[model samples]
Target: MRVAHLSLGDFRNYRTAELELRAGANLILGPNGQGKTNLVEAIAYFATLRSHRTSSDTPLIRAGAGAAIARMKLEAAGRDVLLELQINREGANRAQVNRNTVRAREVTRWFSAVAFVPEDLTIVRGEPSGRRRFLDDALVSRHPIAAGVLGDYERVVRQRNSLLKSGRGSARTVEATLGIWDDQLVEFGSQIMLARRELVRDLGDPLSAGYRALVDGDHGPALHLSESVVDTLKERGVSRETRAEGSQSNVELADVSRETLAQEFRDALSAVRLKEIDRGVTLLGPHRDDLLLTLNDLPVKGYASHGESWSFALSMKMALATLLREESPAGDPVIILDDVFAELDSGRRGRLMSAVSEFEQVIVTAAVEADVPREWDWNRVQIRAGEILPAGEQTSGTPEPKSPADTDPAPGESLSTKDSEQ
Candidate 1:
């Protein structure tokens, strides 16, 4: 997982652009309101297909443009892969891998990326939906096949919710149709829940180690999956582990298998059927789960100071990157730091840089050159209002006059290491 080249058209702020990239630390620097974030956003969008900044795709397309196109040449595991996406406005988007058309969701299988943005702070204090999304993203990255599993599960949940909301027929008629959806939900949802639980289990040790590196004074970070179905099983009775074939007296997240979770999902849905019908929504599944973050036995969201919260969030992202690096077959996933250095103090900034500097590829964006450490030997790209200057050439359309980036390589130009020197 490294990107060798990238080209963009009508994406975010860029009308037409192309740039060659290296496999080490590549920095994109510019002022605020410029397209620095947009540059990295396109890189990451190839991996997850979801924007960290927004929930919709409309903003991704340039204003007044019918569609946007992004193409990339990637090198992973000793081979080169070309990935392309057509981001349309009215109908479904299209995707191509190595020039062959495939389902849009299949685009995620080709690239693996994890991004650390200022918005990542929301994962700590935000709603459970954000946390669940975080889990699913990691799961898909870890096992690309999970994309299909998650897609089917979400479709089942949506269809089930629709039926619950619009049902006005006889009890038997509604119950018969609901059973079909319930079975599909259990089948797909179990795989999602079990995979998420496994990831959280693996994250506990690494997350603790990462936090200690970022912060001082003996603060231990902990991650726990707050699953709705598991809690419900406990409230109904008591036990540590229960087989799926038998009644679920208790749930053990770490040891639970897909078959066992599917059984519990069926039981949980059965117990909540009346309530679900009344509320007109599906409840008691992975969609309702949350990933709990704790520091020294206390939750970080509402109790920890602002610094502690940021530490917890950073550790989570860093820990996920570490896990992927360990498990990836050929190389580590591309790590993107989108305008993140400005938000940190000096010590944390150094710690963050040291941790990621050794990766196969790391892309950083910042408004201030002083914020990034000078020891990095960084390859710099100067971006201003969607115009990119590689390293040694200067160009027009720069937003700020007499800025630090006024003397850098212009667009469509090849750059050298000497060009990046101060």
Candidate 2:
């Protein structure tokens, strides 16, 4: 998919701005805190429905503003589609497709975007939650239904935990109530598990290849889906029986039914009731599951060097990009590189640039132009103190013409001689 245009209103430092993107590579060059990342964040919001930088939406809105609005026109599969998202401080957020109001969840059906930021190194160096989130986001983009399943699982977890914490219900009463949630949880959780398993299975080959290419084949990398449910099911012989079906193995879970998993879940919960009661929280579920990344049979987080961690993180993201291109009907998803070049060596940076060049479009933000490939035919937009000016204008030492006070001109705006004469 290609983003045709983006309009931002009251988003971060951008009071009102519009940008038109080229089909290949678009560069946003700027100093720190100049809202370059904000533009990419707005585009990413269309895909993931959340900001990557901030936990709260309030910070996304301009200071003292009530809400922020992002409008994007996307070209996907030979059709023009419009996506709109409005973030409000108090009320529910609003989403629209083709100017028609739709549920927020429906937005994913139209667009998919993958972002790679410098902080993504955290996936390899930081805590497990970050890696898990990386996997989950990629899965949700590929299978939109997975998002709903995740939401259902989280809801069940909350309700189950609340009941466990109430402390008034008898063991029998709680068991019955817990049984209901366990059934739903296993049903949804099993689907989530299977989806993740399939994703990791498919991604492993590409991830390994990417790692090898990134590091010039000096190291071998492996991606593993570490799951509690899969292990538990295997220990119970369910996995063996399922595998007996040969090519139809995955179908067995659906055929034997969620009821069976639910029964197993109930038994497991019963076995752990005393311990759970003591802890005051639900402990064993998909919510606590993880994705393990190993390089030569060692965890990347504590064991991998800084360069190795960067390679692993970049490989994971590149693998996700490949997956999206394969799965999305909208062609290749737009790539956002947020100051990631600063951390990479010349060879690694060239590899990343080469990998992303096959996509329909790429937008990168960096402090130095040299961070980008010198030969890249990039339409450079220089941002300083939240104002964007074309590279030619900035380099030519000509003052950029003032835009209409209402809306900023799209990227690469030029100053007209007539206006200068006036």
Best by lDDT: 1
lDDT of 1 at 412: 19
Q: lDDT tens string, model 2, 1-422?
A: 88888877788887777677878889999888778889999998777776778767889888877767777888999998887677766666777677667766677778888899987987887777887788778877888767777878889889878987875435654666766766777787777766776787778777887787788884767776655555554555554343453333323433544445555555555556676766657866667777778888898878999999999999988888898898787799889888999899999888888888889999999988887876678877778667767764544343443322234323222112111100
Which candidate leads the pack in TM-score? 1
Regions more than 4 Å wrong, model 2: 168-173, 230-267, 394-422
Candidate 2 lDDT at 195 equals: 72
Q: How many clashing residue pairs appear in each of the predictions shown?
A: 4, 0
Which residue pairs clash in candidate 2?
none
Could you tell me every candidate's TM-score relative to the true structure?
Answer: 0.89, 0.86
Residues 182-217 of candidate 1: C-alpha lDDT, one tens digit per residue:
888888888888888789888877788788888855
